[model samples]
Target: MSSTPKRVLVVEDETEIRELIALHLRREGYLVDDLGTGDLARTQLSKQPYDMVIVDWMLPGLSGLELTRWIRTELKQLQLPILFVTAKTDPEHVAAGLDAGADDYLAKPFDTLVLMARVNALMRRKSWMDSFNVESEQSPHAHILIGELKLDRDAYEVYLRDEKLDLTKSEFKLLEALMMSQGKVLTRKTLIELIQGDGVNVVGRTVDTHVFGLRKKLKDHSELIETIRGVGYRVKLLNG
Candidate 1:
């Protein structure tokens, strides 16, 4: 029997573009839902969960960036992968999209092949994460506590001094890897491999971005994640 197809939501205002993307995604065996407005998309999203979202920066109501922010803050669905398809090709715009919570960005007039590749990569990464969560739930080292920091693998939650921290999926994975290999420096290449899975074309700098975000959220205890200069990162060893 075939497994259930991964579901994808495409939020694009242009009918032709939306249909084109939906067609390609469906051809790749993905069950896709295409919406023309961010507000309608948000409503649909609230009713069901999607493995990934492909959104255009411009929308009739609630711009794609605003929708992304809502998904991260209001809906609190940090694990859902978001890919931005936009005409804003400027580096600043791209950075803004990333900062707004998009997992990947593709400028307008994008090549279908590249779009498919990015979608597949994100899907693979999400699949690995889901598997990790399941396996961790069954393992003895499912929960980790170091000093005032606490991580629950089963819940995919992190707490510092008893206060829960909201983290993106990438940030959560980075912290999990460091805590799992506590006190040991993990090279960027190794970290990427562990977090993104094999065969993904994730750059080393992407790891840095996630670590930066993770540390910022770590707040006062940010130093708990140590940067090893040219090497990588490690969780500080706390004496019990």
Candidate 2:
């Protein structure tokens, strides 16, 4: 682990729950910051970087799902892990929370021990991502600019026609892979590895879901991503 203690943001409207979570995290040597509303969490996020964030489902302003999407899409903090802690424990709600970009979900009444385990696991993931970024930075493909598309690997931001596009972590990874391939067709299996890492059990159709999201955000620039008839997708060659 890095010498720096992991930083965590806990967003919960319930004061007692927020403080309790913060206390546990602090005892585990994490630096924890707590907020009472989703809007406040957004403000705090813009001002500082966090290793992980724990968000409640119901917040005063944006709601947990909306805030999670904002963190992924607008803030582009795919590297930052999010754990959802909410009372909504139904299957559909769990699916929705995961789909909204939560790395893990804990229902209300969850044992604090379970919460700690999830937190530790997410932190391990964070460490791996940090190491991966360091190695990737050594490559020439770290930064790309062609036509109006610009991708800043260091900043985790993607811009099309000078406008930044809202993207989830998967969508961002998928786009990065295609653009870096430089017009080469990437099969679904290849793309899955690029986005989800080797040995990850993600089916190829998961790539399709992410592509659909990327295209939606790309809007008029959606044509830049070309789908092959029977294989996968690629980016059309474009001149800067």
* Best candidate, TM-score: 1
Judged by lDDT, which candidate is best? 1
With a 3 Å backbone cut-off (N, CA, C), the pairs that clash in candidate 1 are none
Per-residue lDDT of model 2, residues 141-225, tens digit only: 3667757778877566799876888776667777876776667898987675545421124578888888988888888878989
Clashes in predicted model 1: 0
**Per-model TM-score versus the true fold:** 0.70, 0.60
Alpha-carbon RMSD to native, per candidate:
5.7, 7.4
After TM-score superposition, the amount by which residue 145's alpha carbon in candidate 1 deviates from its true location, in angstroms, is 3.2
Candidate 1 has its poorest 10 consecutive residues by lDDT at: 193-202
* 63-112 per-residue lDDT for model 1 (tens digits): 99999999987887866889998999788888788877788888789999
lDDT of each: 0.82, 0.80
